[model samples]
Target: MDEITGVFIQESREQLAEMEAGLLRLEQNPDDQDNINAIFRAAHTIKGGSGVIECHFIEAFTHLVENLLDSLRNGDIAATPLLATLLLECCDQMSSLIDVLAAGTPAPDAGLLARGDALTERLKQFIAAQTKQPEASSAALTVHDSSVEASGGGVVITDSWHISVRFGRNVLRGGMDPLSFIRYLASLGEILGIETVTDAMPAAAEMDPESCYMGFEIRLQTRSSKADIERVFNFVRDECDLRILPPHSNLADYIKHIQELPEDTMRLGEILVRCGALTQAEIDDGLHLQKDLTPEAGLEGEGTDQTPPTPPPPQLGEILVEHKVVHKEIIDAAIVKQAQVSDNKSKEARLVRVQADKLDQLIDLVGELVIAGASANLLAQKSRNGDLVEATSVLSRLVEDIRDSALQLRMVQIGDTFTRFNRLVRDVSKELGKDIELSISGAETELDKTVVEKIGDPLMHLVRNSLDHGIEPAALRLQRGKPATGHVSLNAFHDSGSIVIQISDDGGGLNKDKIHAKAVERGLIQPTQTLTDAEIANLIFEPGFSTVDQVSNLSGRGVGMDVVRRNIQALRGAVDVDSVEGEGATFTIRLPLTLAIIDGFLVGVDKASYVIPLDTVVECIELKNLPTDRNFLNLRGEALPFVRLRELFEVEGEPPPRENIVVVQFAGKRAGIVVDQLMGEFQTVIKPLGAMFRHLRGIGGSTILGSGEVALILDVAALVHAVSQGEEHRLLAPPARHKLSAVQNVRQ
Candidate 1:
């Protein structure tokens, strides 16, 4: 029972998934033949699978759907909007059926079956109506003829045989059209007498058009063999009772045909009588004394005698193919499936379904390797042994390579995530009565899978925000000399070892003055404050900040955009906004390529080691004694703002006699980091400090340094923003007596 239930669940889930995918595609391309075919195939597969597991309810429902889709595929009916809606409902019903199966209970609603029946009848009427039109009728008839012709050449027969078929009581309701099977059988052989049995059917009121209460006793007068007859019912053999008998020339055949079968019959004689080949009285009389002996049950006892008919060993390739139950082409493409199981068996080559936790553990171990390599470097440096130092350097390089490889395993392209938004935009655009087109680019950009997973919701909000607020309605767009269809584009790319995702929409650019006014009204900003467009644009990220006059279903509860910004910031990433009035707005998010270990430049500021993300560091230059403005640095006359970390972190030490500045750039803005010394590149494994220190500024996270000291990794973006803002000048200036300490901390 467990095995049967498992099979049903697995098959039902697969069919449901296929149905969902097909329904989505059908919604997009209602007239697509391939889409229709795919949908029909899913429904057909569900019907067949459900029938085998004796789930008559599902089988019956899906069969009607399959027939309708088949009619659509054959041009017997057009794919009308009503039909599509009905099919979508069918998909929903299938989902409900799966839920019921998962819960190990009867289906929740019988209305689904009724609806399915009504939908089937409506589809049938549509097909009938379509056939009344000459052109559609001709096309459908042509398809039927073609299908018949295609089945003509496959008939293979060796000896005449009789086939008895008793379809299940619910077979009709289960969606199996008895006529189609008869048509298929007739294609296999010449029929002599096909007597339809009606003994099992109940009264008319109890009859179900969707259920099969009929059976057949067939005498096929052809040279076709038993195997040929069996092949006709191959797909439904498990759901029906079938028996085949060889032809004979005797009065015994007539007498055995009249038998009233036992509750459970055995052997060739019983099988023949059950198939109406011979009468019961003849079998009872001919072997009256022998009936008690099991061996006298005719050819059925042959299995116990004559070498016991040794069963053929299954072919390994075939067995594997059956057990995996994948498509034949998939098995053929992988040679492992074809190799002989006995000699080629190797544990290493076999596919194993390992828990994802194991892979994460492996990645964690690789991160440890990086930390260990850093520790070894520290040991070698202190030992002052040239060979040991060289060996440690080599080990460090190897560990760096391993670290990169391990992290790469967690990198996945962002295309699938981006594609999902296409549907979202389509649905939301329709709901808002806006003509919006979503264009995606740079989808092949790769990012850490963990980041990608967490980033989706934020991206979604940004997109919805753009569609709702950023994009103007069709009429407004036309009045503004823009295309009726507004364009929203999602692009992604790698920038300086980080993933940059940009969502831009072509609408009337954000109304800067209106936003400023709204911000002032909400007390978010002072009325007298002067602000740049970028600053005004960023105000949208403030919690409960919205410019919409009235809230609608789409957005503007003032709840979403702020959360989007917060989530992105939590990833140690930055989000920037840009807009050109009437040229659309772009929200760009920059995130580290990986969240684990990274190549960093270790520096000392006031005796504290700080790690700077190496990718953001553009270059290092000596800070010569040339006089300069108090906060500005002359990087060949570039006027870059310099942030002295000694003052920023308030470290106690004297300024180094010679100092260097590490120039870093982000979002096209540059800043200089003043450090006591420049340590060459180090592989730093980022370890997040517990929630206790999450609010710490200047320090993004901590890493273990080579000397086994905790090094704070500098948040370059924050430091750069601080230098740009210059709001902490008085706080940064050190106090006296610490006069040398003040000098060390870059005192005024």
Candidate 2:
């Protein structure tokens, strides 16, 4: 598609978003005029722009939508739940049409067009029914000032409206015929009289046959307001000279239109009088009122002793636009020249829409910069030149700043993702005949855009899991002493340097006995094994593990939560479940702020190096009085579970004489990892591990070192959980003294 078409599609989507949001708002507050105006404006813009680009299919369908809205604004039809639902359906259909156009189709398929036709008929039913009512059956047309004073035989204009229109020369070429507009007007009202202008037509030899040169002056009889009448010519407003004069309009009103028009005031007034708006009788009545309001002293004497109290004298016929009522013409004009106002402090302030591919390229470049900067700094330090090392150090700091700024560009608020579940929960609750409300907080928490995108599906599953299994039916909940209406909530905030998203529900929590039985039945665990409550609660994430007896459309087929766990872990994140038997449950997911680059703490064990996220590193201390074979260390009278990286990765050679314990925290647990050397802070660009390394337990991803070797990035969260679980298991079940001594003797 060409640039123009692409822009149209993009703008069309924006308008659709406005429509959908306004529709939802209307559902909440059905009497909100601002929302009604917003919805109307979105639809009007779509219709007008579609005509400008010659999208006849969209224009035709949107015209019907506009008619329905016209009646709504006129107070002929109340804003009902039925109307909101129908409008929502119309929004969906508009989106489908936009998709067809975005896909380079000139028009929608026949079936799609049929769908539009059906929706149009549904809309027309509302409008047609409205017009057929007793009070709205008659059309009110005011002969516009342009021709009420113009000459026509036996044309006695009643207390009706007058409308004058002169089409632009290109109206015909723009796919709008003057006569068709006339037919639409007739549909709105009965035409009292019509005078067609052909004076712009050239002689036969000089006239361009394809160009239009027609003008129209009609005296219409209708019950519509001035705003409604003006909207009749909304499509061709910018391409025409149009004016509507309400019934009983005086000479001043006619002169206002005349001064604004490209014509003499007197001539315009004569035309209005001819069309019956500025008739002699109205003119006589206005002059009589003008005479009555004058000061009596001015008529009686030049300087009387006292002046009678009367209204101010008449000034010249100068009308400021502010003095006039806000008409549909002004609104149409505003829409035609709409400008966007930017809030200085908004995240979208001064934003330019860039393709996602471009952003991805930028991130890739920033990652490369990070790698090269580290390499340069390493070489500079090795050269042992003071000035060179200092300059490279400065460059490294600036490079780090640039990397941070670049990564910040890809960070987006997680709240937007969380809020999408509102409509989902609404639909699902209604489908299941339950009353549920979803509340959200901490929507401003930001994370890497890529992670945000990939996190959505998993979060969807988690929320649905809460709704399906966590929240009970209304009757059951009431019987269980819970509220009749269930509650689900989403919350997010920054924890240390990571983002924590929680989806929680206030309903019946998991039944540990059922889960345990199911686990035993599925052979996932042995009944004889002892487990903590957390460990038992987490059994739900096991593959193909569910306690539901029957399958339903929502869930119970046992295929979701495990995938949620896997996906979260794939992002180098972790998921934990907490629950009480009858109170509630909360699933927590923790993730890094950005996946592109990070400040990592480097460590060396024997001949290998590893990277641990620097943010999780709490403090570093020397290993003192540590047990040789035990996994726990006594620190400050507290047992700190420590993992020996050398033993875990099976590194070669003996342990170093001096060892370091790097204290780290993850998921509310504290642990230590023992390494041979502390290499301090380093800049690392994250590179994903290959499929072979995906199952490698402690290594999350791999990165290149400044010394030209690959260093594995430690999966701190997973390792912490593993070590904590190990310690818990050991304390729960330890080997017998005789068996342990025998095994030690055999080892020696």
Candidate 3:
């Protein structure tokens, strides 16, 4: 029960987040019925879950919110900004209620209760407003929300059905209210008769308040098909034994369904009539016919021998069908449908939900197995044993495949995170009274879960900064010859073994002169220094740097851009800016696909080994460059930059005569690493640097080799950015020559 409660809370909160995002989108385009339906579904899912878990507070409040959302979905109420705001607030209230449930509190605290009440009253008002809308408006739009799930061809719809429900003991304890399901059923059609069965109930002394001891037999009469009737109990289906017999079912069908239920004192005839499947007269007539068929009926009171039976007694169902009391089609459809449901249940039972932490543990174990496999492979080759070497080689390949598959489990689509920003952008722009619109592309790009979690904050800072500073107001944008509504676009794509996220805005781009002046004024740069536009723009990342003369609520504390840079670098990633002063600015963030494990190329710098991400390694070539002072090589008429690791890290030893250059590309710039030996590919598990080594540059992380030697994984992206920022003398600074300018110079 506790485990299920934890799952319910986690999932419900996620659903609420989805709902909030959907509501924000719906506000923009109220006519988007799909988004409206999605929001409705989210609220409905959370409500159903709350009921199942017995969190009545959340369940009840969400019911009201769900009702309002339903009205919007049905076109009974138009989606307005005010209504969207109220719905978003309701999402927050649901989150708070979920928090209370998660804390294991038996009841809501005073503050929580008051907050819920306030939100509830607002939702009721909105619902009331919905009722005041003209009916003709909604009449034009469709409202077939509760249509049948499926209907077989050439089959008649069941008019009346017998639904038997025996809720589990944990239903109430788990937070589900059985009564709500009955109400839902009544909503679908008229619940003609319902008989509560308390035969399973223990004595009052032994009764537990949390336990559910109630069962019910319901007779439903509606035009809805059998599938629709079954859906009312879908939420409790997992926690209840449910059986439905179609209308006009004979005694055989009733007996079959009855026998399938748990032991109860309810008679077959009583169950049938109570479910409204059979009327009183029809059942009485059937009983009378049965009595007449009995040969000893007349001889019971007389001391005479019974008359011999002429033939075998007819079956109750056969008698009903023969008498044309029940349709053969209804009987056959009910039996066939029941069989299909039983098969579906059998398939559903095979699925199991495993916690994410369990998957993480499994991946960690797989990593160890990979290391062990590598060791075995190394030893086998050393032993000069052909069979053993071959066997371990096979093992090594399998382990590598296993590692890839394991990491894939943690790769989630980045779209979920990207869409969440729509709401943020909307709310923030509204607050600032700016007509800024956000457009997103490449939402299907996938990244590691851990990377996704950590990237959100950095992305948020960049986005908010764009809204607060980069985008000009509607009047200003119009004066600049841009559309009145400024546009901020977010684009993500997988590039060269990394995910590149670009945040661009079409407003007044960076004011380079203002930024440079601010930097010089703050002593972040030398007044005499010469820099290009891109270099000047990079000054915004310096600490205590901002062009704003006055602090604004959204930004201008001079604390954002620097932190954004640091956070991105902390993830072994890099961030750079490109902008046209009057056009716009694009902050391009390049992040690795995964931070935990990667495929790497091992290289030896004299005696020390370094690992370069395999995906970034475009190719390796023999070193023949002799460019004086400049740290670049002319490869195939292209001026590709190169860094000598032995010289950069100051590795001790005489230089190896035969050195190789491994060409790597990051963020569209190509660079090379000078090494003495190429040590082939390796599966690398990244371990973070110690606190003492945290300040080290060019080294992202440390990984253990099969020989147990620690090889530092090169921060290829950072190293390339550093080279782009400066020539041979500087590690990472503003680039000496802008990339585009340098390319043009090289081409000339």
CA deviation > 4 Å runs, candidate 1 = 1-28, 38-71, 80-140, 143-354, 626-629, 725-748
Candidate 2: lDDT of 708? 77
Count backbone clashes in candidate 2: 30
On residues 50-139, what C-alpha lDDT tens digit does candidate 1 reach at each position?
787777777776776777777788766666646666776677777677667667777656775576567667756765776677553321
TM-score against truth, every candidate: 0.64, 0.72, 0.70
At residue 56, candidate 3 shows an lDDT of 89
lDDT of 3 by residue, 1-748 (tens): 8988998988887888888888877777889866887788788888888888788888899999989987887667878888888888788788888888989889889998898899889888888876886666421322222322234543223335678788999998778899999988898767878999999999999999999999999988665655576677767766886666566534444444433332234444454454444555556666788778755544443543554534556666555556554445534544454456566677768855677799888878887787788788888989999999999988988988899998988888999888888888988988989988889999999999888989999999999988988889888888888888888999999988899999999878898888888888888779987776777888888887888888988898889899999999999998999988879899999999987788999999876899999999999998754643557778999977777777677678876677899999988888888898999999998888999977777889998888878889998876786665554224333565433332222222
Q: Which residue pairs collide, candidate 3?
A: 51-176, 52-176, 53-174, 53-175, 54-175, 54-176, 725-734, 725-735
State candidate 3's TM-score. Answer: 0.70
Give me the displacement of residue 437 in model 1, in angstroms: 2.1
Candidate 2 weakest ten by summed lDDT: 316-325
Which residue runs does candidate 3 get wrong by more than 4 Å?
31-37, 70-76, 105-111, 128-352, 624-630, 728-748
Alpha carbon deviation, residue 530, candidate 3 (Å): 1.1
TM-score of 1: 0.64
